[model samples]
Target chain A: MKEEIQDNLIQIHDLRISIYSEGSYFDVVKGLSLSVCSNEILCLVGESGCGKSITALSVMGLLPTDVAQVTNGEILFRGQDLLKLSASDMRRLRSDEISMIFQDPITSLDPVFTIGSLLTEIIRVHRNVGSSEAENMAVDALEAAQLPNARQRLKSYPHELSGGMRQRVMIALATALNPAVLIADEPTTALDVTVQAQILERLRERQREQKMGMLLITHDLAVVAEVADRVAVMYAGEIVEEASVQTLFDKPQHPYTQGLLGAIPDITARRGSLHAIPGRVPPPQVPPPGCEFAPRCVHALEECWESRPLLEGSGEGKLRCFNPQPLIT
Target chain B: MLIVLLISSVAVFYAIRLSGGDATAAALPGSATEEFREEFRARIGLDKPIYLQYFAYMGKILKGDPGHSITNNASLVEMLKEHGKNSLVLGGAAFALVFLIGVPLGVLASLRRNSWADHGIMSFSIAGMAIPNFWLALLAIWLFASTFRILPAAGCCSGKQLILPAIVLAFEGIALTVRMTRSAMIENQNNDFVRTLRAGGLSEWRVMGKHVLRNAMIPIISLAGLRIGQIVGYALIVEQIFSWPGIGQALVTAVLRRDYPVAQFFSLVLVVLVVLGNWLADTGYTLANPRLRRSR
Candidate 1:
């Protein structure tokens, strides 16, 4: 509701998304909140089960209707609550304004359709275009993604292409509409380090070309380092720290952030046992009552276990901690 | 492609000759003798050695001059040309029905897994698989003709009469397609692509249609192809029960009357249809499965 920027493309506020299954039970995504500004890459960094992907799916309105429920949330995209839109309207927004590229390339595409068929299907559906025109657009998209033999590759099936090539094709499909926002959920997780780099480069190039705002979700800190302009560190379905990529790397604030940075094997640091956060992340079903990361925080005070920490701050960074790290400014 | 067709044709010819030899050995009391064999051989260009006969038969067939039926004295090629269209129409219509109804129902069942709709489809599928085609045809006759007086029990020529027989034929096809489709869909529902499609802002129905449904239907298409031959086989029985004047009925009449040429020609026709069905299935498999093209 509080969209501060006049040029902001997406504004999400106190987005409390919870997936209820069976009887009125299990809230998978517990009161998560995040935002991505236009033309900026916001990396939603979290371990598995921290509701990173849930938040992304909520934005897309693609969650399974049966087991998943957005109990409460405000996913404001360009001053409209996407959750309240009609299914048709939501669909219109999905492939046009917001698109997503998933992690695994091998399984993301339909094995039965040629890349051309898949591309043309999407292109034709979203635009009033002829098959030939759509195909030409697809070829252009493929070339833009740095894929070789755009014409021949279009005729080929997903399996015929290499892992990197498949990912590139995925990028092409995602960006074909020149979507204003692209949500890439662990897009390079399934590839080799080299292929991952190539996929990332291709995606980055496409993103730059379209000047599209991107929400890059990944658990890999290295990946976050490689592409993220800003990073939001999620813990137990809550963002514990959010800051500029440079600020998060050079001056991590929250204790969890510090612990995460310390845990990274630093060749420059002495070869002692690497620092690690002691406990595992709490399960979503029965997350700790107070700050979700408190139990694992070495600096946990008496009150830390009794009250939840609100994500707060401005300018340089934000940290959700009872014992907040002072901002130098 | 032509070579494979030739080889398959030769294999079928040999199979028929072997079966025919067994019949000749028994030489049913009313049947003709060596005189008949000589006549049949000369008629079929089979007086020559097996290999030569194979080439001659194939060469003639290629030239659209397939030999005459030994029983009815009808041209084998001409008979197929006359009746093949009807069989194909029935087969194609049945296939369409199965796909149109079965696939969507299968997908719905998968989407609403464990729901009443799923339960209904699954139960129907089981019953369809369990009941024999002849029995199903009889039941269809009783239900549509005897009981409801809504449709003719047999002899479908007009598009209107096609409804009952087509539905009867499609019972098994639907069962096979639905069951396979449901199982395949359930399997594909677990695939990462479905998950990815969902993650990519695709609706459940769209994900099911574009990703899960197509992947699931791949196996079904092959099964359906194989079943088309089976349907052709079953068509004979159904045609007999319904008194429909299809190729199957003609073949049965030939067999009963000991019309050797007619029986031989019908058998060959069936074999060719089976082969063509298999070939069509292969091409379909190639087209449906991007994995094949992708692998290439």
Candidate 2:
């Protein structure tokens, strides 16, 4: 119990989530484990349909009840299993203990409400504050997100602001309370590159100032290189490699990570040809029997096709591969 | 708005042509001779060019006089003052019923989606829309007034007298409102903002009440204007069937008698009501979504 205090701010332990559709159920998120500790940024990098977004939603206890369910495992937040918590308790824990900012700012806000009401309502909901205090908090949050005209922008509706401005508003709303853990699901993906950099910088700065644990989910390797303290490379709904960012970038241990790194454009690559993995991610209904990435791996051996390999390594780094891809550096 | 009304008057001007000739002369009593008709026409300046006659009519309207009715020689303003009051009250009550029942039923039907509650409310609205208001008015009279000996069958003098007709008028409006509200809610249900609201740690009730309803309001309000137009149109038929003596019933009588001044006056008032109704709906959307106001 004493050791658990230093364990994690939010830890996902063997979490498995399944989606039900048209008389069949498929596990969108296989048995997975990860954690983000205080003052750290953990990047979860995965392509679309690999269950990155669903995993984020499950942490907030907001998965659509009719379509998806947590079949097994638990999400431990501050040592309490979030899966077993009451709905009312989860409601209170959210926005106060953990908050989330989503990808598309255009449709992520209630278009009918002004920013003032949207931000202040959350403050009033969690704290016994007067309207003036709530207003002050909202203005402070807007300014913290590095937005201009914070006072006037409070009265602007979602549609009145530009996409970048709206994303900033979302950041302000999510971070006003300074929660222990912040889940940002591709928050900068919908913005142009210039705005993207500014948004991420603000996010990193806020994380540093507040020392909040951040689970930043994105498939942009560039983003991973820029802000990740640690990186978990996901393929086919499973984490294939986990390590400190420097180690993962310099000495990727799994073939899938190697393929991803190789796929990045390089000046040395010859014309009309690029190095990319040959196959697509297998459909959930037809996943490979063993290692999920085996079909696309160049290092696949006989036993790699026969059984799923458990994640193995020291606490500092890990890899799940039967035939490893050694570093060239 | 005044220009729009003036343009709409061209349609009304054509309507007079469809009635054959000067409705003023044709509307004279059978006992009156040609001498009286000519004198009456000249007195109203009907011998002038068409544009002059139109200007004369417009000028008359501006002076707070709606002219004399050819039906009973009653002042057009006085007849409308009495009968229009009845129609206005009935229209207001029916409009209230449109939202009071329609909005709630719509919200529930949408929230429940394909459940039994959704099916039930939808089927009820379909039946409401399918059943003719005149037929329903007769049935309401038979059941609530004639058979049960409870509510009065006709007239707008008493509160009880209005029940049968008001219900008949509101039935279709409720149906229309339900369909609009349901479709709007369903459209907004998949919106990403709704998901964002839920992730804010807000309760389910607040999300649905504040967010879903607000996003769904623009369509609901726009449909309400269309519903008001249909209600006014149906009120004409419903008033006749129930012998309610409302403005719509009197307008029908005026049209049938080809009472030119009175018919034109009724058409003008109705057009105003519709324009005003649409204006109110637009105002509602702006108030509901502040983005529209900022753009304005």
Q: Which run of 10 residues does model 2 chain B get worst, by summed lDDT?
A: B17-26
The Cα error of candidate 1 at residue B286, in Å, is 0.7
- Chain A alone, model 1, TM-score? 0.94
How far off is each candidate at the interface, as Cα RMSD in Å? 2.5, 1.2
Q: What TM-score goes with each of the models?
A: 0.82, 0.95
lDDT of 1 by residue, A1-329 (tens): 36456446777777766666555566666667777777788999877888888788888887766667788768888879998999878887876899988888988887777888888777777889999999999999899998998999888888788899999988888888889999998999999999888888877877887888899999899988999899999877778899999989888878888877777887877668876779898866777778888888878888899998788887547889888653332
Query: Which runs of model 1 end up more than 4 angstroms from their true locations?
Result: A1-3, A21-24, A114-117, A120-124, A127-140, A148-156, A201-211, A268-274, A324-329, B1-101, B104-118, B155-163, B185-216
How many steric clashes between backbone atoms does each model show? 5, 0
| Model 1 DockQ (Cα-based) | 0.41
- Retained native contacts per candidate, as fractions? 0.57, 0.70
Query: Best-fitting candidate, measured by TM-score?
Result: 2
Q: Which stretches of candidate 2 lie over 4 Å from their true place?
A: A1-4, A267-272, B21-32, B44-50
RMSD of 2: 2.1
Clashing pairs in 2: none
Q: Tens-digit lDDT track for model 1 on B142-245?
A: 88899999888777577867777777777877887787788898898877776555544456667787677778867877666677787788778866776666
